[model samples]
Target: MSQFPHPSLPSSVKEPWLAVNLSLFFPGIGQLYAGKIIRGHSLIITQVGLYALSGWLILSQIGNIFIGELLLITAFALSIWGIFDAYDCAKTANSPSFEKLRTSQKDPWLAVFLSRLVPGAGHLYINRLWFSVLFFTFFVISLLVQLVPILLKSLIFYHVYIASTIRRERNQLPILGMALVSILFSLIISLQIFFIKTHIADTHIIVTNEMKPTLQRGDHVIVDKQIYRFKSPQRGDIVLFSPPEPLQDNHFREAFIQRIIGLPGERVEIQNGRVYINSQPLEENYPQKLSQYSFIPITVPANSYFVLGDNRNHSYDSEDWGFLPRPNILGKVTKRFFPPQRIGIVSS
Candidate 1:
C-alpha cells in the first residue's frame, strides 16, 4: 500500500446536529460550518437575492397576488432544501470510510426535528437536561394559559349531553356529535379569519406620531380594504397607501397613513398654517398641529389625490412627494381598537 491517506478521509469530523441547527437558524450557515465554502456562499447569495426580489415585488406591485404567492412558495422550498442538504453534508464528512468518529446512541438530528414539533421534546431525546427543562416549562405554561380555557369551554358540551341523557340510555353518538361540531366550528372560524385578514380588513400598529391626537404611536387600528373597492375615497378621509418612489429611497418602506386634503382636479395650497382649497380657506374641525410652511397652489391630477398628516410639520406626505396615485392607496383606517382607553371610530 502507498504511504498516503485516502482522499475521502476528512481532516476533522463534523457534528451533524450542530450543522443542522446552524442551517435552521440561517440556510447557509450550517454548510459553512461543515467546510462547504462554495456551496454555503451560493446558498446565502441565492437566499438574499430571492428575499430582495420578493420585497421589491411586494412594495412595487402589491396587487400581483399570484406572483407574490409563487415567490413565497419558492422561498419555502429552497429553505427546506438548504436545511436537509446541510445535514447530508455533515453526515458525509463524518462517514466511517473517511474516519472513525464518535457516534451517539440517539440521533441528534432526529432530536432537532422532534424539538420543532414540540418545543422541548428534541432536547429531552438528546439528553440536553437544562434546555429540555426550560422548553418543557414554557410549553406547559403556554398550554395552561391558552389551551386550558378552550378545554374548559369544550366541557360545556359534555355537560349539555349529560343533562339531556338524564332519562334515557346514554350513547356514544352525543360525544361523536360534539367532536364533529367542534371541528366544523373551528374550520369555519379559521376560514373567516383568513378571508378577513387577506381581503376584507387588516390590523396595523401605528409606529409614528405623524397622525398625532387622531392616531398616536402604539395605537392599533383596523384598515378597511374592501370599502375603497366599492366607493372612491372622499376628501377628508384618512387613508393608508404606499409612499412615492423618491420617499422610499430614504428608507420609508411602510405604507403612509394620511388625510385626503385635495381631491382629483382640485387646487390646494397651504399658506400661513391655514389650508386653502380652490382659493378658499377650508373649515377645520379635526385636531391638527399645523405648520407655518407654505405650499404654493397646485392642482391635483386626474385619478390622484393630495394628502396631508394631522401633524403637518412632522409628516412626510403628498406636500413633499406630490399627488398620490389612485392605485397606490391600500385602504382607509376605520377604527382604533387598542390601548383600551383610546379605542373608537377614527373620524376625519
Candidate 2:
C-alpha cells in the first residue's frame, strides 16, 4: 500500500466507446488510445499485413474465390480480435495496476484514418521510426509477392524467345531442362490469366437505367465467364458482353449486360412491353417488366442474339445496336455482389 499509489487520469477521459471507435477506424488505434502502445502498434502492423496478403490473393483470382474469401474472413477475425482487446484495455485504463505499464502516448484519429488508407501510415502519424520501417518492409513485401512472379515469367519468355533467339545445336538435356522450365512457367502464367479471364470477374455498380427494377442504379454483379464457354446463352439469361459497336465518341468502352430476349434462329417480337418467343409470350418468374415498346418480328441470324434491358424503353441494347455476334459475348451474370440489400444470386 505504501509502495503503490492511486492512478490519476484525465477527468474528461472516456475510454470504452472511444477505444471501440478507434479500433473500428483502424484495427489497433484503440489499444493506443487505452495506453496499450505496444499492443496497438503490433495490431497495426499485423492487420495491415494480413489485409495486403488477402488483397493480393483477391486480385490474383481477379475477384472472389474460396481461398480469397477465406483470407478475408481471417483478416476480419483479426480485426474483431483487436477491437475486443481494445475494449478490454480501455476498461482497465484507469486501474492502479494498469498505471504501472500505461503509456502517455496518444493516437490521433486523423492519423489512424490516414493509415487506414495506407498501411503503416499510422506509425508515421505517431512518429515511430522503427514501426514505420516495419510497415514499409511489409508494403514492399506485398508488392513483391504481387508483381515479382509476373515479371520473372515475362523475363523467362523474353530471354528464351526474343533475346537468345533459338539455337538448333544446343545439348539435348539442356534443351529438355529449358523446355521443362518454359512449360512450368507457361503453366503458372496461363493458369492466372485463365482464372482472371474465365473464372472470376468484377464490375462496379451499374448507373444505366436500362436494368432498372431487377437491377437498379448502384447495383453491382459478378460475371462468370466459364458459363458461356460450356453452353450458349439461353433466352431470359442475363449476360455481359462487349457491344457489337461501342460509343467511342463518349469514351464508353465497358462491357454491356443485358437479358437475352432471343437466341440464334429464334423469332422475337415485342408487343406493348410484352416479349413473345415463337408466337408465344415468354414466361418470366423474375420481377422485371419490359417498358412499353412495339417491335417488329425479327429472325435472329446465325450465331447472333437479340438482347434487351429489363427497362426496355430506357435501354440502348439490341434494338439500337442490332444483333450481338457470338464472338462478342463475354460472360454471364452470376450474382449481385454490391449494395448489401440486393446482394444475392441476381438470376435464377
Candidate 3:
C-alpha cells in the first residue's frame, strides 16, 4: 500500500515539468496545481508584494541606477527559487512525508509582516540566523553607500528573503491583518507609480523604425522629465514630444521620438541627403540612413525646434508637419534599459 493512500491523493496527478512552467508564468501557480493551497497563495502574495515594492522604489527614484539593478537581481533570484520549488513540490505531491512537512510549516505571512516591520525580523522568526545576518549586513551597506534608499532596500531584501523561506517549505494560511496590510501597501504603491510616471520619469517603447540604428522598433528607453527644466533643448538631442498641430489633424495623437536637427532662430534646410544649419553642413556623427531630399530653407521660429527622424528616408518628422513647439517637448531619452546587450546611455 502506498504511504499516501489513494483516497488522500489529488484527483489528477500533477506533472513536475508542468508545475515548473506554471511557476515560470507566476510563482505560486504551480504549488496550487500541486495541491499546496496555502503554500501557493503565500508565494503569489509574496511575489506580488516584492514586485510592488521594487516598482515603487524604481519609479520614485528614477535616477538611482544601483537600486534598480539590485532590485532586478533580487527579482531574478526569487524567480529561480520559485521555479525550482514548484518542480520539487509537484514531484512529491503525493508523498506522505511531503504532506507531513506541509502541515508542519510556519505562517509565511507572519514572516512577511515581521520583515516589513523590522529589518531581518522575518528571518529571525523563522530561525534563519544566517539570512538574518546577511540582511542586516545589506542594510548596513546600503546606509554606508548612500546610493540606495535604505528603507526601500530593506523592504526588497526582506521580501526576497521571506519569499525564499516560503519556497523552501509550505506555510499556514496568512492572518487577516497580514492580508489587509499587503493590500494597503499595494494600493499606495500603485497611486505613487501613477504620479511618478506623470511628473518624474517613465519608460517608453519604440514602435516605429523612425530612429533606426540609435533606437530600433521594440527598443525600451527611459525618458527624463526633469532634464529640460535645468537646461534648454540642444541640437542632436533625442526628444519625445506630442505631434505638432498639422500632424494632429491626421490622427497622430501619440507622441513622437526624434532628434532635434535645428534650434530656435536657425536657418534649417535639407538638400543632397545632408542637413545644413545656417548654410553650414551639420557634422553628422550618429547612425542614420539619410535620404536625398531637398527642402526650401526655412528659419526655425523662436521657442520652437525643428526635429527629424534618424531614419531620414522613412520618417515623418519636421519635414512633414513643421517645427515642434517647445512646450510640446515632453522629455529627453537618456538610457535604453532593455535588450540587455544594448543597455547603456543613449548619447547623441
Q: Which candidate comes out best when scored by lDDT?
A: 3
* Tens-digit lDDT track of model 1 for 1-348: 122223444447676665776676568988998889999999988888876676344323133333544675788799899988998888787767432323424443455445544556666665566766776666666666744433433333333323221212124453445445544565676688788776777778999999997999999877877788889999888998987777877887888899999999999999999999999998878999877699999999999999998999999888888889998888888777677677567877
Clashes of 2: 0
Candidate 1: lDDT of 97? 45
In the predicted model 3, the residue pairs found to clash are none
Cα error, residue 272 of model 3, in Å, equals 1.8
Better of 1 and 3 by lDDT: 3
Candidates arranged by TM-score, highest first: 3, 2, 1
Candidate 1 segments whose C-alpha is farther than 4 A from its true place: 1-191
Off by over 4 Å in 2: 1-75, 78-194, 246-251
For candidate 3, write residues 130-185 as lDDT tens digits.
Answer: 87788867776776653344354445433643454433322322223233444455
- Span of 10 residues, lowest total lDDT, candidate 2: 161-170
lDDT of each: 0.71, 0.65, 0.73
Best by TM-score: 3
